[model samples]
Target: MFSPALLQMILVAALLSLLSAGKLTASDYYVATTGNDQNPGTLNQPFRTVARGISSARQPGDNVIVRKGIYPQARTLNLANPGTADNYISLKAFEEEEVIIDGSNLQKDATLIAVLSHHIRIQGLTVRNSQNIGISIWGPGTRVHAVEVSGNRVHHCQNSGIYAGFNRLHDPVRDLLIEDNVISECSLMNEGGRYNQWSFGAGAGLSRKVTIRNNTVSHCYGEGIGLYLSNKGTIEGNTVHDNFSVNIYLDNTTNTRVSRNLVYSTEDQRFYRFNHPASGIQIANENYQGFNNPSSHNVITNNILIGNYIAISSGSYQRGGGLKHTLIANNTAWGSIGPLLHIDADTSHYKSRISNNIFKQTGNVPLTDIQGSTARIEFSNNLWHGGVPQQSARSTSDLEADPQLINGGSFNPEAYRLSESSPAHNAGIKLPEVEQDFNGKPRSKNFDIGAW
Candidate 1:
């Protein structure tokens, strides 16, 4: 036998040779449209259907590029193949906004489904009008990167525009980047398949490292984005609006950052409906199912929480366990009929860090912890307007004063400010700086009054 160093050199040489000689060529693949399946699936002599392309993709690095045009087929493209990290199976749009995957005529109880594939990217296509979810990523560890799902307009589907979760077999679906996609007008009732509205607009289970950003998720039957049992993902810089549920729901999740998102119309401030369907963001324990632990150490900061009943809610639906060490900071909320922040529920002692928020309300108490536990929801320096007290509780040091805003009460609907004679103009408690005002200036003091 050869020496170990010689074996290593031989392996490296073989890898380099494969990288150089086994490179993929675009001209070697075929095209599939509607008509004759007997044709040689080349670009010039293309086959008639997508079914033939699947039969032809027998190798690991083989590609079958779906050309741009209206594909009227209503069948689910179940790719029974796997691609490697180097050679991936690509089913991309021939041209941006020019290719369409029409699922309009799917039979009753017939949903278009893609299943059991690996290392595949569905790029730049309009997948819409189905009985269930328009696009379902069923494979475990599938990477859906840089696909423009705009003007595709998935509607009237019983489920979601694009739903990603675990399969019935409990396979893992992780490391998915759902970006620049538009998923709207999908039904989110109690009855659905595989993925449900109860978890996420699309939910994930026991998965980590998912980034869902820069998408417009509106007018759905469920929440804009619901995360259950998801850990360490960035749900940032997205516009989630007009869903029946919370703009973002975090249940039994942890180490997730929700920032720089615009969530609006989450509340109806009408008198009769006051606190009935009150709109606000919620981070609850979710009844403490035996499967997962309670949510902890979540950083909810630097977002605009406006036109809702309660801006932020912490430690809800706690049975016996406690929600510990959640950071609710750097958020601005206005026009709340109920308390701007409420952390009162049936649970044992809980620990939460409530600090540095901007609350503008109609005399709605800014901070409230009705649990009456000895370890109250901690608070430091938060800005409040409209004569609302900082905390309605009897223990905490509630600062009831003007927060000397730049535009005064005229600019703030709740009329929050530090009067020329008041000391709270810049006299805020010392804290770390996270956000600045509209004028790009840091909080003149160490703490900013409201969510910028």
Candidate 2:
């Protein structure tokens, strides 16, 4: 056998030869509106259409970089090519240039961008005016995994802004990272259309190990951000507001954590007057046909909710599956029009723990309206104030007094922070799962009562 040094040199030479022959190297394809598809996809000679550039990027680590321009597609931009576990194919705007994918000319019910494969990264693209979903990352009858959709602006879609799911339960989508996206003005077609008012700003269903964080979602027809039939998902640090229905909804989800989110509705109820009431967060089991998953083992903590019809709720909408083993803690809710927490009567298998929350109301509305059996629920160490006929009897350790939050009556999220001398400071029972406050500060051994 050859020496080790000689063998390394030979291997390096072979790799150099392969790269020189364009055999083992990733490629970058460019698209520009002023170019033509017949030209080579390069910086100077770029493809005219985004489809041409994406089609040319057929290998792992390939990038389809679109220049600053508006490319209106008459059909869906189907990203069917996949990368490997170690390498990801990316479709992104070129070097901070604005690339708008306008789907105004597309056929009805067609999505703007359809990610049909795995190990894909779609970033920094503005997608708008689609008849259906703006960006849909799903595979029909197949499983899609390891997709990252970040820093995109998706708006004016007739349906959901961004969605990832498959109808088949066994072929669930997995490992999605959707973060730092601004999604608004979606679900425009839900106004008495074929969709039946079921659109949202951004949502994922039938998926696992999904992280949706730091997104701003607003003014949608349905829930701002929803997770349905999904498990092991984290919905964190999202600013969701002014949606028609629930701002953040967990339907038929298990082992999900919704934390540190800012959810609220405007005082005028801008888009909320159309359909469902303005709810900050809702956990339910809708029991869609063939999917009987229940909402269980979920944690909602460190969130700030303001001016919603209901701050947080749990229920069984279809009367089949129900919420169980839920933990609602370390949240601050204020200025709710109705009861801050509402539990439906038909909720089967209802068992939850509510603690370290600040439920403050401005009117005579009760802090909670529990129509279900409350025997299984444990309510403790919460601060309740400004509601008539308070529900303090349920918890022996609960305090009925002003939380003394900084500017507590304001709609600003920072206004709910606990002051130095506030009664809520260091008054909460320690929850092991909640190690940080709403502002991402580490909680001390002596915990605070509400989100700070």
Candidate 3:
């Protein structure tokens, strides 16, 4: 027994719930190499091209499942349909089969896959051989959000392997997840005359709340993973190596966490004769076009950096904004050609902290090359071994002893693990930011000095 108005409200709520449930009920559209475009996009009668399958998936919770084969296209695969927050439109390979989106026939500057809409999931596909970018998630007029690009293999691109950005200052893209993908041999167009200097293996700029994790990025012409002008991002559990420039670069990024990453370079010579050797991690302010945004309040912890020109470099010579309030803690740096940690003079007034790190180098190279102001930088409880002693005066609790790594010469992460009687065991001050080790193990109450 209800009043007329209450009954009316109940009826409306029931109708809205029914519509929402209808939105969540998904339809599957299939694409096969031998099928025809005029088909109904079903399992037996699939669409011939990926574009037709994408066009058929028009509603929320719809899936465009491409079967096993190489589908070469001359035009870019555009994902322009927007889905709801709860029901994402998915473009994925079918049943764990192989699906390659080849862009070898496209123009030199044509991108392979362009994600122009929000709430889309692209997964389990191999994208390669684009003269430009392999996958690009960007929109000049609209703000893209909730785009997940995962479990893909992208390589041999002339420019960036994967890129996402927006140019507008206030209308930045949001909520991007790039994980468990493999990107290599990207930025291949980087030569002296026609080099695309702004390329990377995987990059995201002008975005917020981004998570890039567990990806293997290697052998790129530029930075392995670059985050520029992005805020509140997490770069974790990534293995980045052998890039021409820096391995992991944070340019004008704030409140970002770079942790549990393995960054290294095996190349003895510079990729370009005019360019400097590769660095493990570079935190700088490039100040592209006078943006002047400071790369501040960042946390770099629990990483293994090996055999780079410089393991960790802060500040830039470009003369834009400077590094401020960065915390570098609980990391292992070994076998660097130059200084293990190089802090430039540009970071004069900032209050940065370096603690609980294991800095070791061979030969006459200095452990740290702090060139500029050091009045505000804090150094404490670091285990230093084998290098010209440059940090002894700055830190009182620093130990000059053998870290006794298990196999110090190898490139494996387990090789940097501390031995049973190593001096780096329980030799760190407690820092709240580092709750886990390099392998994602929980840190003990008595924290270890380096990443283990």
The 0-to-1 C-alpha lDDT of every candidate, in the order given, reads 0.57, 0.86, 0.86
lDDT for model 3, please.
0.86
Tens digits of lDDT, candidate 3, 347-401: 3447778899999997688888877667777889988888545642258888889
lDDT of 3 at 302: 95
* Model 1 agreement with the true structure over 258-326: per-residue lDDT tens digits: 766666563332211223332457776665344564677677776666555566765555442454767
Position 54, candidate 2: lDDT: 88
* lDDT digits (tens) for residues 66-167 of candidate 2: 999999999999888989888899999998899999999999888999999989999999999998999998864244789999999999999999999988
**What is the Cα-based TM-score of model 1?**
0.73
Query: After superposing candidate 2, which stretches have Cα over 4 Å from the reference?
Result: 1-22, 140-142, 192-197, 268-270, 273-277, 388-393
**TM-score per candidate, chains pooled:** 0.73, 0.92, 0.92
